[model samples]
Target: MPWSLHGGSHLPGCPGIMEEVDKILIRSLRLSGTEIPDEVQSIREFTTELIVESVVRCLRVINPSVGAGLSHILPPGMSARFRIGMSLAQACQDLGYQGEVGYQTFLYSSEPEIRRLLLFLVEKLPRDASEDASQPVGKSTTLHRAIAVAIKEQLAVPWVPPACRTPRLQLLQGSCLLKRFQAQPLVLPWESNLVPGKVPPERKEFFVKFLPPVSAQLPQTTSLVPSLLERNMAELSAAQDWESEWKSQGLGSRMTPEEYRQWKLQRLQRRLLDQLRQASPSLGPAQPGTTGRDLIQLLGSFGAGHERAGALAKGSRFTHTQNLAYKQEAEHPVQVETIPISRTSEQELREKQAAELETLEGELGRLVGQIGDLEGQMATLGLTLTQVEGEVRQRQLGVTEQEQTLRVKGRTVELLPDAENNMAKLQVVVESSAQRIIQLAAQWEKHRVPLTQEFRELKALHNSKELESSRRLLEIRELHERIRSAADEAKHKEDLYKQLLVELESLPKDVSRSAYTQRILEIVGNIRKQKEEITKILSDTRGLQKEINGLTGKLDRTFAVTDELVFKDAKRDEAVRKAYKYLAALHENCSQLIQTIEDTGTILREIRDLEEQIESETSKKTLSNLERILSDYRAMKQENTALLGRTRET
Candidate 1:
């Protein structure tokens, strides 16, 4: 017995040997049917009973709230491999349970939660409660009640949490103060059950007694509470009207209440130093011997004792007006000397004719500045004797009466540099005959300026034809009366062309009878025969209106799409409703990520056998060479989901 799962094996290959029992019974009979294996020793006894029933339900699925009396706490040589579905694979390799739990694929799919955990534990199990009960893989009576009925049918009641419904139970039934004590915290309402003779009129025995007085036993206290002794004698008559103003100003009969409080504190510091010398005539004024330093800024602004310091010293006055000055001593006597005068005769002939008219206008302004320096040296020596007398009249007009600039200006300002080189060679022969007499007087003013503007525009057309008048003397006075009225209208048009040549030999005639020339030859042969039968019925009504609008937009979008691979029973009932919603959301997220990785009971079952080989390769069907081997299986499942989403996001 101990060899089946607890104490070990069914011998032949020892230690919980049936390795993943015929690979989970040929992947659960190829996920429950789909002929893939015709038999190779029937897939080796179907993976040795799916690895001896997943090592006899790997420790109730690795502690999923484990309890089902762990199959009578496992040992007994795996008690025939924990009965019915056998294989307690050596009690799950001696209890250190590894992964995968098939308990015959959880009792052939949760037989009503392993029969409600075999009627909840059913007293530890040596099997039968009418046998068929516990079934997380056929016939196991307990695994602590098939893991306490697959963890009490997998928990999850949570979603009902926010209980307060019905407008928050009518807002907590309006804060139920016992519904305002309409009383039920033990209701009585005159003992409620209504009218038992109006509940209370019970008369039995009676007793009257005279009980009263205690000063007459004493408790009434005030022997003079005349209104609390007239409010404490009106606060002792306002403390005797505050000592009756120093006892009617006689200063308490000459002082001694400690000298009448030091004569009312030196008459409130001499009426606050006469109200701070009548409120500051310069802070210095208070010094009539430090009137207690202006009684500390005038009794901290007037008002302490002595009838408020005798009304602040009868309204304090000596208002210190001082700033004086005035003087008066300088009265008589003083002296000093020396003086003289004269000069008359019109003050000395106007001082000698104004000193002879200022020395004759300073010798007439130095003889008019030496006659303007000899008229600027006789105007530059009369321009060098007028350029040596114009080079001796251009050498007497070029030796007509001259030569060599007339012998160099015939020597004057001493051969003025050979008369300035014979007056620069007779001024370059009078500037080359005055530039050919200014180019023949500018070509005689350019051909005499359009012949002097056409002789002044023909003297303005002889004074505008002397202001016009004759039309050749009125055409020779109307050519003898227009040649006698055109020879009397050519003798009256030669007798009206001889009476129209005798009425054009008398008669007349018509040209052509025309009804618009016979309606233009009958509209040119009826517009050439109704233009070829209206262009052949407008080309067959434009190709049947383009195939009836392309068959009404292909019956609204390409023959209405949802062809979902038409029938093989609607593609295997849509791939068994997409493999039961992708293998039950991939076996419920791979059994909650392998129960959060074996609930951290780590012994890494290679990422839970690679998430049960990605849930049997996502319920099959990806062909094209398995989509080219699932394209590097999505880059190794994106590096194993980025290393398990960074190990479950930290």
Candidate 2:
């Protein structure tokens, strides 16, 4: 058998060595907060086993033949040293360090070797293989160029700047030389002036030599040539100034003099062509055929340069004339008498203006004060208006209430006579009612004793029936309670039956022992007997219920018969009572008829007396009363007319 390193098979007699190593490892694992495997028992024993196994593994890695002999690595006396060694190796391995040297370094040299070995390994490792495999940094190739082209293609533009030629980025290093020259791309406008106090000499020369000569050539179109040459010279001088100005400004130096000259020539030709076209508008818009040819002629025409020269000459001449005038004015300045106002008048005028200003200021101050006063008054008026609104609302409410009271008074006034008449009629009815009540009371007194006796008898009978009904109600309640108790008992028996069924189902079928079998058989027999007894009881109870029902039917029949006999007796009593009531009513009716007859006789006598009195009274005073009433009515009407006239006068 051979031991192996890095998870290999174990040799014979390695168990003891392995056990020692395991003990040390387990101890170390426990210290490191690792749980010991169950197969490793205690730390010391596990350490012993671990050390032996690790020693064997290490020895095998060193030499396989030595691994076959466990004694070579694990001697009999070096158990502790062996445990320590194996623990170190395990710790190193667990921590992801390679080889037994790592463990030895940790224990002996305190891991200086690990750092050195790490540095060495890092150095030995290839640097960024993907980067090496990729395109060399900063060394742009055709492929990079192709990529750039692809980018430009994707951008849908073909032009690339010289700055974009290299892959090396110098973001802030390069000068923005193109942007410096951006504003002066065509020509520098500063070239129009050479210095602060001096005019351009070329402008004067052109005015004298080229432009004045054009006045002589105005009669012939062929005279355009010399002026064109003069203009060309002036433009060339301007272009030179532009170039010099651009250089002085240090904007850009890359633009060539030839390119500048060509650009200026083209611009000058364009300007000349435009001016020529404007000057000769009768020619209309240039024909398409001559348009290109005319442009070519303008560019080629040196005479075209004379046009700018002539304009510049005219401007310079005017400026020269002005300068001459200015010089003459400086030499011979005009003098005129100065009219001066007296200091006293000036002081008086100032005083008058000051007084006016003071008055205006005072007026402004007063106006401001007035404005404040007006604002205060407006606020006071607003408050007053609010108070007035509240008061008006209150007055309106009071007026509405007064109107409602007036309406109520008016209605009362309208109803006063009707209320008085109703009172009189009600009084008369009450007197009549009093007499009727007296008569009815007498009648009621006459019949009340017998009715009271009858009522007393009926009340006694009703009280006896109520007592019987109360007894019957008590019996019925007792029966309902008994029935409820019987139902509860039946429910309890049903629960017990269910419980017995569950037990029967739970009992095993294999119980063959005499005691269990006998007990189960006895319980089943008892259950069956109980069931039979319950059934018998139920049957007996049903039979008893049937007998009770029969007895109840007999009792009901007997009660019904008694009730019928009682009803017959009650009916006979009721008939006798009704007959008494009828006799009483008949007696009352007779009395009422006798009273009515007496009342009628009295009424007839009273009526006869009233008629006699009415006849005598009417014969004596009817005419006299009518005459008095007519005279009084006429007097009242005259007095009312006089009162109306007096009210109208007031």
Worst 10 residues of 2 by lDDT: 1-10
> CA lDDT of 267 in candidate 2?
65
Segments in model 2 whose C-alpha atoms lie over 4 Å from true places:
1-344, 422-650
Residue by residue across 1-650, what tens digits does model 2's lDDT show? 01112111122223443333333334333332234466755322323334334334433433456445443233333333435555545534443455445333322222123233222222222222111222222223424655976777656744446567443223223344223211111122234434434547786566555554434545554445555565567779876676456554322333465565555566676676678765532233555446557866544433423433222222333444455556655776645334356544677677766886796567556655665565567557756766897799899999999999999999778867899887787799999999999999989988898899999999999999888866776675577668868998898667656655544454455533365335445544554676698899999989987996797688557655755665555666977656555655675686688679779989999999999777655633456546745765676677778889999999
lDDT of 2 at 439: 93
Model 1 TM-score, 2 decimals: 0.12
Residue range 346-388, candidate 1, lDDT tens digits: 5666676688678656755665566556556755775676589
The 0-to-1 C-alpha lDDT of every candidate, in the order given, reads 0.44, 0.52
Each prediction's RMSD over C-alphas, in Å, is 61.5, 61.4
